[model samples]
Target: MAWDDKRVETWVGIMLRTGVMIAAAIVLIGGVLYLSGRGPSPRNNYRHFQGEPAQYTSLSGVVHNVNLHEPRSLIMLGLLILIATPVARVGMCIAGFLLERDRMYVVVSTAVLVILLYSLFFHK
Candidate 1:
């Protein structure tokens, strides 16, 4: 379609509508990983730096713990990050739609926002 066409803004609507849906999927999967005890350090997180590479930090203090090296868990974590990638795209889409002065995208963003909020609240 022509770039100058007014309906071009619909592309923005489509992007915003799709992005948050993907984010919802990501957090859901992340919740599953958390439930399954997938993190490398349950009580703390691993920190790599100049001083101590094996040190982990959490609510407690510095400790030593092996990270989760399980392939399945790693894959799940990757999937979770993948699921979260579209959030910025949604904002970009909203900006594009607003720049084009499109009202359709406003409605789309509203619906997407509701779904996004619902997914956040009800996610596993």
Candidate 2:
């Protein structure tokens, strides 16, 4: 059982495909729930710009809302998962490089991961 480049690539491909599929499924379910629950005559207030609720703005808040089985929060969760897929792929690459003792790639992957995290969380 050797951890070769081909093996890593295969796993990465599987991970990406699985992540996207799961995220899409979650979003679809959430959308169905939302549409079913919303009775006829839905609110279509478009004059004023409205933002997401405070609970959905933060990760903790989104998780809390999801715990309560909120449809919007579930959709948010799906989106979050979708966004995280690439980040996780980068992390997996880092690990794969580390296992192969590839210093150059490990450093490059780490830098990329740091930049990604910064843009995702720290950018103003």
Candidate 3:
């Protein structure tokens, strides 16, 4: 089972497409919910970025809102998925490199994944 560059490229493309499609679907659902008067009401206080609550901005907050079927949280989750597409692509690249026995690329992809993770989860 030889995993060549072309095969890896195809796999990455498929992964990106799938991730984007799923994210789009989730966003669409959230939009529908919002337009149907199911989400939170609009805010007029535009003084200090009084947008969503603190729970909706953080990861655990998003998850909690999602569990409560909050439309905005679903939309946020979709955006998160969209943001994660490239990260997943990089992960697939690492897997492909490992399958092809390409140590150099595996290390490089791993570093990229680490940086992405750091920026997404750890960086302020």
Candidate 4:
């Protein structure tokens, strides 16, 4: 397939829109699940700066909770997917550049992808 700037823009727009929509749906469902019951907040301390639960703090923890259909985990998963959308766009850019025989952009996109992956997987 011949890639052009217009095609790149269209691809990026579609990716971003789809990612946001899916994430929004997940978050909305999770929010519904979380708010449907569980009664009122303890002591009505809505202003308190309580941190997130330990289960939502790590990748494995989130996955474990998600297996149990935990609402917060589902919400966090949506946020993670939202965050990953741009990374996926960068990957697509790399492929597009390769297809277009644009060596410089291919290299640049690869570097950016590597940096994103490093930050996501190892920088923590």
Candidate 5:
């Protein structure tokens, strides 16, 4: 099957929207965690440029069991918003390919998505 350009664009839009929502959600969750006394936000359970989070750099990235409150909630929110921008751009491309009814693109996206999901759960 092949989708026209308009339909492909729609799919791309959907993916972009999804990315935006995900970014917003991550920010919201991070804010809640930080305001609750956790510390700096984390990319995830793991830290970048470093193997482990030194046990003190969990989601909060603060002292163990210590929860103070977000000193810069707005900043964290901004960072998340920035993160989503590029994500949305790329997501749109992928989504568009799928929506275009390109079987090749669809299969590739599915494989990539599956791999990503698996890594998220079991790559540790």
Candidate 6:
């Protein structure tokens, strides 16, 4: 019933492990789908060096493609989840610090969380 440091650490660890495992599973499934759809000898135009499509660059686009069962989009979504894991960890720490009445840590964690969000969403 207590929100102690050990308990918080344990939960954070669980969250990180679960996040990575889920991301890996999604990426693995996407890779399998990609390979299966590509056939035995898919094209490899290395010399051309075509970049990633615009659809995979934005969150909405990725979601749209994911809804359509696009393999690359699924991989992108997995990567996005992987990236979000640490941000979620920071958020959890903020909550833990708040519960512990640790003002200094709460302020520091909040700053870190804000910076992370700014960089992730607004730093263009």
TM-score of each: 0.37, 0.87, 0.85, 0.85, 0.37, 0.88
| Model 3: how far residue 30 lies from native, Å | 0.5
Instruction: In model 5, state the lDDT of residue 120.
Output: 36
lDDT of 3 by residue, 26-97 (tens): 999987886676446675567886567786667667766684256777888898889889999999999999
Question: Number of the top candidate by TM-score?
Answer: 6
How many residue pairs collide in each prediction?
Answer: 1, 0, 0, 0, 2, 0
Model 1 residue 111 CA deviation (Å) reads 1.8
- Model 6 lDDT, residue 101, Cα: 90
Of 2 and 6, the candidate ranking higher by lDDT: 2
lDDT of 6 by residue, 12-34 (tens): 99999999999999999998998
How far does residue 11 in candidate 4 sit from its true spot (Å)? 1.2
Model 5, 6-110: lDDT tens per residue?
A: 766666677667767765775666676655655456545544466533433232333233323443443344454555465445455566676666778767766
**Which ranges in model 2 have alpha carbons more than 4 Å from their true place?**
43-48
Q: Identify the superior model by TM-score, candidate 2 or candidate 3.
A: 2
* Best by the lDDT measure: 2
**lDDT (CA) per prediction:** 0.50, 0.89, 0.85, 0.83, 0.56, 0.88
Residue 10 of model 5, lDDT score: 67
Structure candidate 5, residue pairs in collision: 37-67, 37-68
For residue 77, model 2's alpha carbon misses the true position, in angstroms, by 0.7
Q: Which stretches of candidate 1 lie over 4 Å from their true place?
A: 1-68, 86-88
